[model samples]
Target: MSSTKDIDALIEMMAKLPGLGPRSARRAVLHMIKKRALLMIPLSDTLQNVAATARECLNCGNIGTSDVCDICTSHKRANGEICVVEDVADLWAMERSGVFKGRYHVLGGTLSALDAVGPEELRIPKLMTRIADEHITEVILALNATIDGQTTAHYIAGELETRGVAVTSLAQGVPIGGELDYLDDGTISAALKARKAL
Candidate 1:
């Protein structure tokens, strides 16, 4: 009805993105419009290209522009070790750290009984196949700390145990900059339990 109708729609769509609220979306849209030539056009073209090409990797379920992601295809990644994560974001986070030099398996989500999600719904079967086909000897569970995450980790551990694969979990402890006074009781206990013997 108004001249700003298209701009309003754009703002609404951007607001639906994970971390962007209506106010932030409005600001972002306005900023983009001001830098239309430098930012908006490139962003629009890139979004379209990625939308057309992006797909989940056949091997590890990581989002990529091909059947298998680069990480899965890379010969340098340790073949015997696979990091099992709840989502692609977690995989990316681990990559950012540059610590684990191995392939990753994105489970899509945790096993949720309330939501009726199970191993069949996730990529657990695919993971088992990868382990056997790749001759994997170790699996590092990088799941979150939620109840459902723990349940899924335990279930996967049980499955891998029968296959004679060594299953490990990320050590839960105080963060690099976290203060003990600000941490929750569970974190304190986990950190204490995982303490080194130095």
Candidate 2:
């Protein structure tokens, strides 16, 4: 048997993680092995604990250690607006921005006919329930700028319009310090359409 067989298996599993290729995973595994006493042991323990307790929040679909995530349970986050995102990663990204003070609703994924994803498969029905139960005044669609994302946004907008709630989308524009030459035509057009008075 190969002496490094177990370590190789660990590296292979780590490589399957997003953003970590074989080379990166090999380096990470080697580093963890070298720092076993300091980093590896603690990391292993933490991972085990998280694997045991991590769960999806029943109300909003955010992953947490409990049935309801901290944001969903917080009274301070019960603002009149709910920002809907395509996934938990998007929700985490929005939270990292610290610009939005309201709660979030994760849709799991965009509506993709190819993937057979539909509103029923996502948390759309729950979002409607939240709107009525929470007395939400506005819904901010923060989905990605993909075709499926836009389709999902439009579908949700149409649904909310009939319920008499304001539906808005995140403005598409060139990023701060981004040059016009580097932008796509659709981005340029969207920026132009959403231009504000100076």
Candidate 3:
């Protein structure tokens, strides 16, 4: 058996994580090994705990350790407005800016006909229900500016308009094909503040 088999396996697994290459993964594993007590052990325990308890929020599709995420359960977030995002990362990005006071709705992905994805595949139906049940007055479409994202936003806007809810989208600060997770806090705030009706 290879002497470094376990370490190599760990690097391989880490390499599969987003934005990590094999070389970066190896460096990360080596760093963790050098700081085993301070970083590796605690990281392992935390990862295991999160893997065991993490789940999608039943109400808004955010990931959390419970069936419903903290944001969805917070009464203070019930401001009759919902910011719709393509992923949980985007939702977290918006929250980090601390500009929006309303709640969020995470659409797992955009409508992609080429990829065979449709509204039914995402959380659109649930959003419709939330609009009615929560008496939502406005829905802010914070989707990315990609083709699929824009298509999904338009579809959602049309749907909400018929329900008498005002729909708006982030301004042109977001470059085409740029994702929310990549934008800085100031840019997110600017886009949101200058949002236009859809």
Q: Which candidate is the best by TM-score?
A: 1
- lDDT, candidate 2, at 25: 94
Number of colliding residue pairs in model 2? 0
Candidate 2: what lDDT? 0.93
Q: Which window of ten consecutive residues has the lowest lDDT sum in model 2?
A: 1-10
Model 2 residue pairs with clashes: none
TM-score of 2: 0.96
Model 1's alpha-carbon lDDT is 0.94
Rank list by TM-score: 1, 2, 3
Name the 10 consecutive residues with the lowest summed lDDT in model 3: 1-10
lDDT of each: 0.94, 0.93, 0.92
- The runs of at least 3 residues in candidate 3 whose Cα sits more than 4 Å from the true structure, single-residue gaps closed, are 1-3, 174-198
lDDT (Cα, 0-100) at 91 in candidate 2? 95
TM-score of each: 0.96, 0.96, 0.86
Over the stretch 1-198, how does candidate 2's per-residue lDDT look in tens digits? 253878989999999999999999989998999999999999999999999999999999999999999999999999889999999999999999999999899999999899999999999999999999988998999999999999999999988888988889998999999999999999999999999999
Worst 10 contiguous positions by lDDT, candidate 1 = 1-10
Q: Could you tell me the C-alpha RMSD of candidate 3 in Å?
A: 5.8
Query: How well does candidate 1 match the true structure in TM-score terms?
Result: 0.96
